[model samples]
Target chain A: MKFMSNKTLKMSKVLLSAVLSVGIIASLSGCGSNESAKNSATPPADSAGSNLIVSQTNPIVIDKEAKTVKVYTEVNGKYFVEPTRHGVVFKDGSNGSKSVLKAWGNQNDFYNGLVDIGAKPGNNLKLDSVGVAVEGDPLDVSITWAGAGKEIPFGDGILDSTKKGFDFRFGGNQENAKAKNTGCILCLDSCPVGITSNAAHPTKDFDNKIAEFKGNQEVLPADGTPVVVTFKLK
Target chain B: MNTKQRKWLNVLGSGLLGFNFGFVAALLLAQWTWLELRVNTGLAILVGVGIGLGIGLLRTIKRPLAVESISLLAMLISLLGIGDAQISSLKILTGYTIREGLLMPDISLQVANLIFSLLTLGSILSAIVLKRKISG
Candidate 1:
């Protein structure tokens, strides 16, 4: 009996140390991941979407002061997401934002997976930072969003095999990305259907849309003609 | 130490941890989904019990637990907490857009709930329970 007990105790100690050592190593490795996989992403030498000064073309967008959804994320496979009852909250002084998944029915799993993927909260994404932009709402209310995946299918639930997509114009406004020119596109080639809003208060698009952009290309503007932008905000 | 005593310590400490984590996860999920019930309470209890028992198997443990064991638990809790917080936030933000009756980009809350409860937290919590049992 004594031998068994002593053996168990010794073995447990060794295993415990191994467990802790492994964790420390993992966290340390993550800190340096920001080292970047490629040369600093050159802002599209004119890849600027709107505001010219700041672009919302990237997967994630941030307003910094507003604590709201400038633009969110959508993976290709994810089908549905829940709505954010609280809306978005932003961390102050952040230069970037992560693409957010819409919190649908399975929020817990979605969230945990993200953290595993290194989604920074309180620093990058603050859930409790309820939209100060929206008044009379709970400050801590965490807003959940639904995820959209399949490419922009055409009306009647079929893929738009045509090159007709919307030519998006930037509200050109930097104050708040309120979508303007949401109507009337001069061209619609290889574009989806219409102008619609995405994670950003206004992910300019041709109407008849749903927010989905995983395993897909960046949403180009419609009309094949550059959507002239004019940054105007409140 | 007697095997029975080691077993009890492992089981009880791990059990408490499992219960506490489940409760916290539920709260966090609720916050993310903006729904009253992110994880069904009854279902959560069942999960918690199963986890507790599994950990209890590691119940024959060392005393006082160790630094490494505790650190691992902390890491898991921190990670899960952060994830839950994000999901809750997304739900709230998307709610407003949809309320305005606009179809927008959003991730599914149900999926988040499952991942958090069954996979992430569930795995770590179970692991910790066992760790504590063995350490004791």
Candidate 2:
């Protein structure tokens, strides 16, 4: 390194600083203005006022080329939830699914809980935030959280990504498929019927229709698309 | 460079590499998804890559693969900072950040921008510290 001239070091400093400063400024500056009240500080929590169920969709497709998952979900409230497609979409690059899930808690347990409890990851999942609500019986969602915010049905550990994620699968008639490695604590142990496990097993719980379709392809009755889905909440 | 010096240098260099690509991916997520990211995705990525290339230059000048551990560690650290940076600013901008991804699909719009912005910063900081030895 001594062979390198001092001029070279100085140039490196200037260049590194220039690039670093610019990158930092771009990201921090582009947030528009936090001071503006226009910021939707609070995400719409309940869908009662809309007289419809709010739906949030996660569309996940396996990208065999990348040996990784390329996932996209509807950020704004949406509808027509599809079960086969949802689950954490694993993006190959930044906004990587791993850390992002930490903001919520643990994607595995949370996602698994949702699926096992009838919440599908693909475009078939719905919450009361906005969009179309399921017209059937009301959804019984057990919720939890790691930080402060509006309480979500079956929402907990929404901000934690350090732990192992939970597994989402269907219950084949042969045996209940247990998607292991749950990241969230078991919030609910008892239900009206004995169909639920003290450990919040989605496969054992009969309440979750999404969990019933694990490992097997099922045809969707609503869209006639031969897809699987869960009941969306409004 | 000596074995010890080379090892540390690589640590700093590797982070820049991971951070560069990570920054780019983060920006796209912000743009495509309505989720507001903290930093400008485009600029952040450029910065990350520039710093990474700079680190790479330093490595090749002295040694190659000497900083392998550092690179992997830095990459992981870079990912961690992304969330940190976003949450810090988000708490200030909105009363809350992402507790649940209710707004957008996977992440909340509120915290999305903030998280990636912080990630860019983390990479920049890593680059600066790592390059200091080489530059000086």
Give all candidates' CA lDDT scores.
Answer: 0.29, 0.31
DockQ of 2: 0.10
The best candidate in terms of TM-score: 2
Candidate 1: Cα lDDT at A116? 36
Most DockQ-accurate candidate: 2
Give the alpha carbon lDDT tens digit for every residue of A87-198 in model 1: 1111111100111122111222222222332333212112132211111111111111111122232121112323232222211121121122111111111111111111
The 10 consecutive residues of candidate 1 chain A with the worst lDDT sum are A222-231
For candidate 2, the docking band is incorrect
Error of 1 at B29 (Å): 5.1
Model 1 residue B18 lDDT score: 54
Cα miss at A216, model 2 (Å)? 36
After superposing candidate 2, which stretches have Cα over 4 Å from the reference?
A1-11, A31-234, B1-9, B22-117, B134-136
- Model 1 alpha-carbon drift over 4 Å, by segment: A1-8, A37-39, A45-51, A55-234, B1-62, B66-136
